[model samples]
Target: MNQPETNPDAPLPRPSTFPDGLRVQVQGFDDQQAADGLGEQLTALFVQMGRYFDIQRLDGVTIAIDYEEALRSLDRGCATRELAPSRGRTVGVAMTPSVLRDGVLKSHVFVDAAVFFGMLKEDRYERAMQLLAHECAHVEVNAHYDRCFPDTLLRTKYMNAQQGARSEVILASWDEYAACALSAKRGENPEADYRETFLNDLADARERGNECIKAYRLHSQVGQIVREIREIYGGLMKHAAYYLGNAAGFGKSWRDDPAVAEALTEHWFLPFFERLETALAALYAELGVWPNHDGFEVIGDIGEDLMCEGGMYFYDSPDHPGEVGVQLPLTPDTVPY
Candidate 1:
């Protein structure tokens, strides 16, 4: 949908200066050597991101692989504490095989351990770096959002499973989009990076030898889905709005009826979806890109029907099939990198 172009020349907003104690821990692996190696690598990565995002004052971030402890921390309501106002911090990293195969769903980050091991096995350090960078970007985005609009975006919980799913899809799109943009500039291979990280490792060698074959295939399939969603649908901002809006409308309808308050509370995406569009626009502008019709178009193809389908549709559709509407203005008058 079309929105007024965000001024490309606008000054970028800086990340938070608050001292949120960010930490990362690894779990499910028994090999001390592997755990230590992963921990060191993750620590360096966080340090780099902290400096880049200007969160130095934030308590040092941690990376651990203690699946049991991580689960315990999460089960005993660790997220409640982690998300507490006074102790606003995030914990996550490249997940181990066991965690991915059989861990309770948490809001925590999950990196495919097999994929990670595959990258390491293949000696694709550059690809591994890209994966690490992508996960780290999520942390940066989450922290930035928390600091900038804690009440509006961070506090509202998704009202239903549908809304939650929609929010997640959009969030994942943006995460990958940002990661792709950053990785491209840094000379990283997105496909190889994802493939090696998600598909190449075995989660259960004894139960299912060569099991990763199917998992690897599935990874490739999902990777393609994400790419198609970005290329065909449009940018993350537009797609996210489409799903989030529907979810929000659904939640509001239920909330208006007191009988469904419990159900609504359990299933809304409002918490994360609320203000997501604005936040994305701000981020796009900060990155020096215009948040105009053309920018959204390049992110994906939003036709008249899909545009109208969402309440926020703003861009004009093409006159005919297989055509672009208009090119949005970008900063520096140069092509998008």
Candidate 2:
């Protein structure tokens, strides 16, 4: 009998067993084998990133996917980054991309049915992996901002901005824009470029007479934010949903999922970004952060609300009273951990 070929690129024996700092807590699924495979894939992805980015502390995160309630959460309205803690130690402190110290520091992600099913669909698994990568990118971003600011309110403003006092919406959206640029997983797994995939899908849509996704790079940070500010989602969101659904074969039961992505693209994204840029200019004008700008430099030593101190990263203002702010966290964390 012929022997199956072996992969030369398979990782060498590591010091630890499975699930180092990064872990998985799946709920509402009865399919153990499939879930285990999913968990293993996610764990390997994290491990690969840990070594590639040199993030020793990458193990401090847990990602949960509750297939059942995920769609329910979307039905009612929900936010991404739904499974994280609320403190400095909880947010994590992976000192660099290459080294993440493992410990009590925590961050997490919650994937729902729409994305879960999409990931399982043939030819779409790697595309969904990029979305997961976006969420993973969020872990470090959270660690950077949450630990950078000792005060909850300051971190709140940095993350949520016009978003409500509890919303960490902006950071999530920003990272989403940052994470999907690569063709596939950077360190280990090889897959198609997400941008290329989207373009090919867009071409497929165009051939089918759909044009909502616009033949531009919707995969970039500035592109997403700028488009949303222009109220692009108002018109394009539904069409995009149709395209996304058709591409994934998700059908009508998952119709709203893409709309939710579209809605979030508009609401949570714009305010924080608008305010952050304004605040950055103010900080530079005041010269608080010269060259070495850690994410926390804007927050000051003791969690001073930068907006009130002649700064503006949110709509509420003592200087400009009665101005509107971003929408609040409209939904609860579906898989609170």
- Candidate 1 deviant stretches above 4 angstroms: 1-24, 54-109, 158-170, 191-283, 287-337
C-alpha lDDT of all candidate models, in order: 0.37, 0.34
Which stretches of candidate 2 lie above 4 Å from their native place?
A: 1-22, 53-105, 152-337
lDDT at residue 223 of model 2 (Cα atoms): 32
Tens-digit lDDT string for candidate 2 (203-305): 3321221122222233434333322322222112222222232322211222244533343354422243234334333432323223343432332211123
Residue 308 miss distance in model 2 (angstroms): 18
Residue 249 local lDDT, model 2: 23
Question: For model 1, how does the per-residue alpha-carbon lDDT over 1-337 read when each residue is reduced to its tens digit?
Answer: 0112348797535544323444444445788676766666665455555444434323233233343344334332212322211111112334211111122211244454555556668877566665655554444544443444434233357543223334444444444444344434222444433322222211111112123223434564533332233222233233344332222323323234343334226332233223454454444455423333244332222222222222112233456543223222222122111
Q: For each candidate, what TM-score against the reference?
A: 0.40, 0.39
Tally clashing residue pairs in candidate 2. 16
